[model samples]
Structures are given as structure tokens and as C-alpha cells.
Target: MKNSNTSDNKDMEMKYVMVIETSDYLHRLEANQLNLFTQKLHNGISKLLKKFDSQILKQDDNTYIVLFDSVTNAILCALKVKSNFKYITLKFDKSIRHLKIGIAHHTNRIAAQTLSTRMCEVVKNQIVITSEVKKAYEKENRNTFINKEHIRTLNFSEEQFLTNLMNCVETIWNNSDFSIVDFSKPLKYSKSQVYRKMISLTGKPPSSFIRDFRLNRAMHLMYDRKGNITEIAQQTGFKNPSYFSKCFKDKFGVTPKTYSKQHAN
Candidate 1:
């Protein structure tokens, strides 16, 4: 146990690991083969991180934004191509071992050393966030999937995964207030099927996806309108301010109050 802990610590120190999985992609594949592609990607990342004895953090669904940082490993992970917008099945695989992450936090240096593993790279040549993630998801219009973001660059396999997962992200994004009973009735799929689909696409259950989506949407709402945190919470489907605050901090790395202070103009 001591050796295992030591090894884990070493992995955490030297390497930066990030894993994002989607269930909608899994839905498109056979039941027995859910997340195999993502598993391979995760395996590759784990292996790479192990070489550096890096620490790993896995975030499910469309929550990759939370893993952004300026370290070389973080920057390399951010550049990983998981899917494409136009093509749903072409996988573009690249080794991020040599990628150098550059951040503006320090003009004297190229990246942020203080944030060790929390930041991802800032690539001038890359457009990481796109409307395509939203559009591809809207096209599906299901209860279990939701559109999150579209990959600017992807190969065939990656495209396939994005097409399916983006749809799942959209499904969840549009129906943040939908109840489990409603989902079970309309889809006519078993509860397990519903759970598995969400798990495969978002690396989280359906409920967590909805909650995070609501929080993200609430953040947008709070940013755009004149309202208090309580109002934003209710508007985003939270019945209680306390729970909403907890979820907000868990997802965004800060309380709603802090987020408002940081972003409010």
C-alpha cells in the first residue's frame, strides 16, 4: 500500500491527466462496447502520464473547460482531438508528448506554474469552442443527449464520437428541467438503458449532466440579466439557493458570488 501510494503521488506530481467521456457516443455503439474509444484514449493518456508519473483528473461530459491550464502537459491534453463536427466517426489521434502550452499569465515565462494541473494551453491557432457542438446536438433532439461544443479539428472516428455525444449533450442541455419520470415515459427505454447512455456520453449520470448544464446556463443568465443569485437559481431549475450554490462551486471552481464578482462588469 505504501509503494502504491508513493507511485500514485509520483504520477500526480510529474504528469497532468485529463479524461472526458460522453455517453451519447456509447449509445451509438453496441451495448457491450460502451466507451471503448474513450477508454483507449484514457488508456493512452494514463500510459503517457505514467511515463512522467503524473496525477490524473477525469471530468465527464462537456466539462473539459474546467481542466484548462498553462502547464505543458495540460496544454498537450487540451489539444487532444476527440471528434469532428462534420464527420462523426473519423478519429484523429495525436501524441501530445511534445506540445508546449503557452499562456499570457506570465510574459516573462510561457505558462502558469502556480496552477500546476488546473490550466490548459492557450493555442492561437485553435478555436476550441464552436457553435457546431450546439447545432449537432440540436439535430438529435432527444431527452438523453445534449449538444455542448464542436471540435474545430477532428478526423473520421473523432467526428463520429462528437456527432453522437454532442447530440447527447444537447439533449440534456435543452431539457435541464425534465424529470426522470418524463424521460422514462417518452423514450420507452429501461431505466438502466437511460443511465448507461448518459454515463457513456457524459462520463456522468443524466442528473449530474442536467445539474451542471443548469448551472452553466445559470451562469450565463446571471451574466446577461439583472438578478440575484437566488433568482438565477430558481430560473435555472434549482429550488433551493443553498443546493444551487454548492453545485455552482463544484462545477465552476468558485461560488456564485465569486464568479459574479470576477465576471460582472
Candidate 2:
């Protein structure tokens, strides 16, 4: 939030994390079991965090949020355990619901936009925790398990900078192909603008961020044995393997084949 040029490698400490109920559906579980369910979530999250190198802070309650040092590690955790959550009804004595999680580690304005934006799901209203909540918790010095004042606050100007920057990152991340021209056109900004925004939000330029995101997805798919390179390339928005390979090598310093071989083996 200060934008004070903090160390890029600065470790993630205990930061405020809040979970909001995003769905309109009732929790349905009995009061006694609700406590147990939250415990599962708390413990499940703790166990998941151990798989990554980052740190996590959880409290005695059913809710928990962690500050992760690496976005990559965070993403992996989010993806890996998202499907493992099961909510049960005490009366029914069966699992009846699940959860969708929203997470943010910084208190910049960009973090606010991420929470306020409506999710893509057409029918359901989305619920999210905002960066303002982080500020509020910090002001009260009551972040629970999260360390007090772990994150710095930002002013209006700094907030706007973060918001614009995160928008660019999301734009590139959502786009299937790393088509710089098309995505940049939406902002009516120059390629440099998009590039700078990407750097500010994700510590990388547009092409680089998109490449890494795609590669991460590709790895998951390859691990699942879901598709071959040609198919995966197309699915990820690369028109052909040659173009994908070139971009991949430029980022990873190796051809996809070699990279996959090294990682897979």
C-alpha cells in the first residue's frame, strides 16, 4: 500500500484474511456441526499450507486467512484443495454444500477491486471481503490470528494505482492467448501501459505473467494426462505449438519438451 518499493522477496507475514459466505443458500448444518465444519476448514487449510513454502495464520474460530510469500504457492494451494471441501447437514446427516474462497494479502486499492468485482457465475450473487476490511481490522488491532499491522495501508492515489494495475493483470490472466494488442486496446493504453501495470501487480510484464499462468495450467493438465501439447496449446489460446514453444522457452529458458521431461520425471 505504501508503494515504497519494498523488497520483492519480502516474506509474507501474518496478514488479515476474512471469509464471507458467498452463496445465498443456507448453511443447512446444525449449530453443533457448524462448529465442527469450521474446524475442518481451519485444520484443512493448515495442512494445505504445509505443502507450500509460505506462511499461514489461522485462529481458534471456524474462519482463517493466510499471508503467502509466493503467489504461485498460493495458487497451487487454492487449486489443489478447492474441490476437497465438503459441507454437511447435521439433520440430514449428509454432505450438502461447499465453499468458494476469496483471498487477498495486501491492502492496496487494487485488492479492493478484486473483491468488489462480480464473479462470472451468472445466477448467484458473489460475496467477497474487501481491502477496507483489512484496514478496519488493522485500525482496531484485532486481526485475530493475523499479526497486527502486518500490511501497510494505501491512500486514494496509491489505491487507484493498485486498482488499475490489478485490472491489467486480470485482463491478461483471463485472456486465453497472450494477445498483447487486443487486451491492451481495451484500456486504450499503450503496450507499455499494460506492461507496466502487469509488473506492478504481479511482478512481471503482461507476456511473462500470461506465460507463467498458462504454463502452470498446462502442467496441471499434463499431470492429469488430460491433453497433449498441441491440444493444450490451443486450449490455452496459442494457435500452434511453435508459437507456444517460443514463448515458453523465452520465459523458462528451455523448450517445452525438455521442461516437461525434467518436471515430469
Candidate 3:
């Protein structure tokens, strides 16, 4: 290894690096769906980064590595991206519901690379920063780091619970037979416990959550022009096309056929 003093000196250089990636569920989507989701995500992130004077150094599928000359801009960009995530994914058929961000302040490209690699472990919908970044941000701004609305970090148990819950939903969401019992089995939580926890966290009970998830997927499929109404309904786990059309109308204010025609390419 190189001398410790040399590494320290290199780290003293002024550069900020930010890494962003969507939830693990993105990898579970079909290729077409994945492309559509990432494209939308990238567009939204690019628009936000423009306000911060940052450059995207690299991007691989859903993961983006961004570089900034100013720590304040990097931190502000992270906060902005996190705040706008839901809006960014609003048009997606199956949304990328969360983003995990890691920000670091370093002197050189090598040190920035190392810092970004370690930040990959950050939890979903969370923003994590190095001590250097935290210090630099406070020095540049009058506000304390803890006072920021976007600085919230989930505890390990809460992170794990959300991860498991989301993974479970993604895995079984396309099954027409999927029910509250099926939803609870993978989580190992009883129906009532899962019900309360989901409501507390998402403000929607399990059944409504699953239904909304399905309806969202169906809407995306229509946008993609993936198939006719019947096939889209079946693919998204609705028991019948009529029921799917009714739900679609209830959620979207128009029937599926009308949506398909209006959005057709």
C-alpha cells in the first residue's frame, strides 16, 4: 500500500462525487420495462444535475456516477434528486420507487472512486455522505447537516424490513392468485402485522397497495403498447379484462382502451 500521509494529502484535494442507483427491483423487470424506467430516471436526474453544475462521469443501466467541483452543489443535487424521485418515476409503467445515493468529498479521481465504491452499501431511498462531505457542507452553508429535510437515514432494521417487503411484492406482483396471505408469507409477518406496518409506512393497507401496484403496471404496459387490453390485463395479474378495465378507469379516469389509443405511438 502507499504511504498513509500520501493518501491523506490526496484526499485533501477538493472534489465531490455522487453515485445514484434505483432499487434492486429494477433488475427484476423485463428488458423493455427496465429500459423505459431507467430512461425516465436518467432524464429526471439530468434535469436536476443541470441546476448544480455537475457532470455525469459514468452510467451503467440504473446506476449513475456524478462529479461536482463544489460540495454544496453535490449535496444540494442529492437532496433535489431525492425529493423529486416520485415525480421522476411517475410516467413509468412499473416505477423505480426508491433511489440510494452516496456522496463523498475527495482530492483525486482514485480517492473518489474508492469512496464511491464504499457508498454502494447505502440503503434504499437514503442518502449517505462521507465525514469530509458533511464537514464541507456545514462549512459552506450556515445550516447544520442534521437540520436538512433530506438527511434522514433509515436504521438497519427498518431498511431491511422495507427491502424485504419490496422484494416480496415485486416477486409475486404478477401472480393473479397473489393475496394478502401470499404477501405475508415471505415477510414472515402475520396478515394483521403486515397490514398495520404497511399502512403506517405507506399509508395504504396491503390489498390497496397491491392493487395500486398492479394498476400502475397495467398503465405502463398501455403506454409501452405492449399488447391489446386483454393481454395486458392478464399479464398484469387481473383475473379478467372487465375487472381490469373497471379498476383502470377508477384509477386513471379513463378506460384502458381509451388510454391505449391516446398514447399510441
lDDT of each structure?
0.44, 0.49, 0.71
lDDT of 1 by residue, 116-234 (tens): 11112211122232233223333444453322242232333433433444444456554536765544455555767766755653456757756766775687676566589998887
Ranking by lDDT: 3, 2, 1
Candidate 3, residue 219: lDDT: 75
> What are the models' TM-scores?
0.38, 0.41, 0.56
Q: After superposing candidate 1, which stretches have Cα over 4 Å from the reference?
A: 1-178
Q: Which candidate is the best by lDDT?
A: 3
| Candidate 2 Cα errors over 4 Å, as ranges | 1-130, 142-178, 242-265
Clashes of 3: 2
- Please give the lDDT score at residue 99 for candidate 2: 45
Ranking by TM-score: 3, 2, 1
